[model samples]
Target: MTELDLATKAPESDAQEDSSVDSPTQSSPIMGDHEHCVTDRPAPAGQGPTGEIIKLNDIDVYISKPADYPHAPTRLLLFLTGGTGIKSVNNQIQADKYAAEGFLVLMPDMFGGETAPGGKEAYVADNSVSLLEQVKLKAVEIAKSFLIDMWLARVTEAKIMPILHKVIEAAHEEYSDAIKHGEGIYAVGYCVGGRYVLLLAKGTQEGGNDEESGMMKAGPFIKAGALAHAASVTPDDFKNLQAPLSLVCVENDALFTDEVRKVGEDLMTQDNVEHEVQVYPGVPHGFAVAGQYQESNIMDAQVTAYEQMLRWLKDH
Candidate 1:
């Protein structure tokens, strides 16, 4: 892990919360609404992408294709959202931008159309606490009660693997004539989504080597992956990863600290896995998807990180 050593500033305390903790639930039609599940036009700009919503194995996946798509995309991107789950405004913006650049982007609702009971308002209810305090509390609650105990339990490999298979099947069906035979399918994820990327790359639904046995596998389709400000990932998690990986770390991120970065790098190197770790200065966690509220430096960092991902995808 070579360090670039770019000048950095302390992260500012912006009012915004990481999407992983506090995002509004999207109003997209749920599964079984066959007619409304797929649409040609997306929601308003800044809200969602200008693409169609398709149901994959009963999951409502928002798919944004290039305007001239079916001409075959250079690559297919499975863009996973942060803790805020799918339908995060920032995630939508990122997906739309990538689609405009000719990549087919798919965003699945990680929460299966469910959201925090009170949504964004729940985070702000206790005015006695600072915004940061609220975010921290909400993050812990979601991680323990929802993410680990509920969501992941229901959306296991049995459910998710088929969705991945179906999405790829649909892509091939639509662009059969134009697809380049050896072109790749790539994945990029932020925060909790990043953790999922690693799981997919390793062909298992859960982390750790022992737990992977008999898990429904789905890694073969993914050629490469990039993780940005990932959470809950341990060095051991990378030992069995099959695809080349890129780690986009933020200098001031509380979750992805220097120690965690080193552990990941050391493990990847020892395992002889191809990997790259780049640290962006002056940014907080979730900068890749939600840096719009930060200063110019943070915004610039966000663009630079995104460009790095594009380059990595092209090179790999």
Candidate 2:
């Protein structure tokens, strides 16, 4: 199949863990979008997570603090997950990496407990299935959750933003003094998670979407935000951006298409917000985290996106 074949379906966020290993993979699924190509195979191993999952107001948060720095972190970062949610050990591992760099990272479980059915796999260079064969596979898998799109649709800014606000409010309060010494709060999101990062940038000083969306105005959380391969972004989402943003886009994506991306960037420019947009050619959606499970080229691009995103948060 062609390189883009894997992402031709729904947003590819169905990554699963090697359940046989002793980890949180066996736990019940929760909230998140299926915006990445997923497979049944166990993904690449990350350095074992150094932080424990702590329950905070019904949300399971993976908190990682700086190593030797006793003062505030370099930045208090809220790591919004891809569709994989906190179930993605890789997301936790990524957070730990940020913590090692002297950033306090908070990765919360937005997915209460709900994983996607898996029949497809990552976009590995080794896969040689014919187009016909892959299509047939997707058809059968679609039967598993014909409402997959509807299910994904439920994770809207209105529905999930409050949960995010709760997470940030509680984490910020807990890390009060140390956070004050830091560079304030920043965020990075992957896949559908990217959409929320943008919303965080656009949110009110009370935090979350407009009160017209029926959410109570919560405390402010995000200072700046970054996202990669964002999915489900509407032009209206960009109309009132309030924070700095960095976007690492891929060349090909069905959801975060060029037109939509242009609209968002143009709006950001019109709003005179601090932002940066770069599209890495030849990669598809979900390359930031999901690509690490694919071919070496994909993985390399993913690594570059990581470094650029980190720099954006620290220096911006």
| Candidate number with greatest TM-score | 2
lDDT by residue for model 2 (1-316), tens = 0111112124435242221111222222111224243432244564567787887656788888787655433567888876666766666777787888778788887666554444344222113555454445445445534556655766655667767767766766687655576646788887667777877776453334543333356423577888877766677767678888888877756656767777777777888988887778776466676324545776788789889898988875
Of the candidates shown, which would achieve the greatest lDDT relative to the real structure? Answer: 2
State TM-scores per candidate: 0.69, 0.78
Cα RMSD, each candidate = 9.8, 8.1
How many residue pairs collide in each prediction? Answer: 3, 16
Candidate 2 — worst ten consecutive residues by lDDT sum?
A: 1-10
Q: Candidate 1's residue-wise lDDT over 1-316, tens digit each?
A: 6531111111111113433323233222111111111111222245644776677645678788778876554567888765454555556777887788777788877556753222233333234555566566655444434333343345343444455555556556654442343265678877656766766777443422322223234454577888776764555556577788887876755555566667667766776778888988766565666435437786787788888777776677
Alpha carbon lDDT at 92, candidate 1: 70
For model 2, the superposed segments whose C-alpha errors exceed 4 Å read 1-42, 69-74, 120-136, 203-220, 290-294
Give the backbone clash total of model 2. Answer: 16
lDDT of 1 at 33: 12
